[model samples]
Target chain A: MTGRDRKLTRFLRIAAFSIGMIFVLLGVLRGEHLEVFAKAVRICLECIGIG
Target chain B: MSGMHRDRVETKDRPGLHERFRLLIQLASAALVNGYAAGFAGCKIFTGTSKMVCLPVLNCYSCPGALGACPIGSLQAVEGGAKHNISFYVLGTLMLFGVLFGRLICGFLCPFGLVQDLLGRIPARKLHVPEKIDKPLRYLKYVILAVLVILLPMLAVNQFGIAPPYFCKYICPAGTLEGGIPHLLMNESLRKTAGALWNWKLGILILVILGSVFVPRFFCRYLCPLGAFYSLFNRFSLFRMDLDKSKCVDCKSCENVCPMAVKVTEHINSPECIRCGKCKAVCPVDAISSRFETDMLTRNVAVKKVD
Candidate 1:
């Protein structure tokens, strides 16, 4: 790839990483960590066809 | 045995060191996720706060020994909750893995994939569904992801004002194998209460297992929504397969060894590629490599040079 193209590719990778990190941070801020914890601790009876 | 038989029985490529190591890692990950507690005596699943984190595999959350939550199950829980909220964390987590490694998780981390791989090792006449049929059938998982996993949970609610995760409730053989069977074996009360739905799920699970013996990764090829979702990100994932055109002689050795049936030479980075690195291992000329690539820019540069 040309020098300019390589520079652009690097920029895009950084952008992708930045965007992904933001989403991850948003998820944590939204209390998703605790929400998942609450759901995970208990086995859903329905999931195993008990319900 | 005739000349035709001799020609057909081309010696299978022995699992190279890389493959052996990959299998070892898969087994280790599977064991780690499925808790190491002694017997199946405890009906209890690990309820540690750490269980909040999602593992990228199709392992069942209800698996009595599971240390982490299945991403798909946790996703459905969030969508099916009374509040009916979209799970940003689950989506973000999935996106993170999808973007970073694409379906390498399917290749190396999924317990169900390991099970399928083992079943395919059984000496039997293997079957390959015709590409005409297989190509169309692959779209089935995308539909399952769209309708059962996402749409149904978001739109359809029962009388209790809660939407059930239709995919987990109605399908998901992994759930039956990892969670239902173990729980039923250990919990007498559960056995006594088993009904038609349980029997139905058991039948599906059995069918899937049987299918795996004949067609490698039947569920992964045709029914795994998690795989389908991850495939969407394969095109842009940081880790990708790169075919060095300068070195390639078009020998098609890489394509011949691919378990996922990817047209390796044509589209080395196809979404269907599990990134198992088998193609790279099998390539005679060392033309294939799996690593981070600036393929998008490379493609664009070939089309129109950036000044």
Candidate 2:
């Protein structure tokens, strides 16, 4: 609630938001969307340990 | 043990409007992600475009009803892939969730958390986990996150240079319940081929379900890697608990009511806190509040105005 604390919180918020946005951009670039789709569509029996 | 703590329960026997609304949101969120008609038949996993992104909760990706992928499962899959690539998308999404709401997801949105909450209402004599054992056991989830979810998948590769999602394969009661059981129930062919690993997972699922009846959120408190991951960001999450020391009565009522056994007065924004608002609800002096105060920019500094 002090002036210093308020400023610190503000700075931290900006920093956190910046980092989150960067990572999201990286995710779009790094994540293989087609592979994600492939994994999502089929039932991996190994996931449930049958096969 | 304090008089205020004892008095707190009687005064608020029935849930207030906010609590009712929270439960409603939790139910709706669960159904929204996993409401596919084909899910009931367990014949197919949804291959929709929505499945490309991860949901904040621990809903299994393999669940027939799941429209969104489980972040933990996706992270493991990404780690175990032939590329052995670290999933910035999954990590980033989870990080965003953590910084925004923290474990409020556990309290208000997770389908698995809803299961535990309903089971906790079974009227059984609650088994209070002693703080000595509980404190150390809390670290187990972090270890699981590091080892089973991350490290094992990254390290333990086969002849094809790919690894399996060890956590989902060996642990994850969510996958077992939402994916395994449903598939087995619907697909008669799978039941005939059910092996020891399947039985092992079933045992773990049964134990977690029974344990929830006696200890509220047993999996969350001790086993959920997702909760552990979210807990790390609780201190600085956008939506957070704030204790106005000026209004506090030293009554310890908040501590008494907290399901997570968080020492609220000691650490108002403790990482273990699920932001259930139970402490705020029970506070006789209106000292405790949950606020959405990120910065001066979007500061909604509404205090404990809940009735």
> Highest lDDT: which candidate?
2
lDDT of 2 at B151: 91
Candidate 2 stretches greater than 4 Å from native: A1-12, B1-16, B296-307
The candidate that wins on DockQ is: 2
Distance from true position, residue B140, model 1, in Å? 0.7
Which residue pairs clash within candidate 2? Answer: none
Model 1, span B1-307: residue lDDT tens:
8986664443234337678888998899899898637425677778887688888889887888788888888888887777546777788788778878889999999999999989988999888789999999989999999998988888787877578778888898988888888888888998899898898888888999998999878899899999998998776677877778778898888877677888988887788988888888777666777766556434443422111
Measured on C-alpha atoms, candidate 2 has an lDDT of 0.82
Q: Would you list the clashing residue pairs of candidate 1? A: none
- Of all native A–B interface contacts, model 2 reproduces a fraction of 0.44
Q: TM-score of the candidate numbered 1?
A: 0.87
lDDT of each: 0.80, 0.82
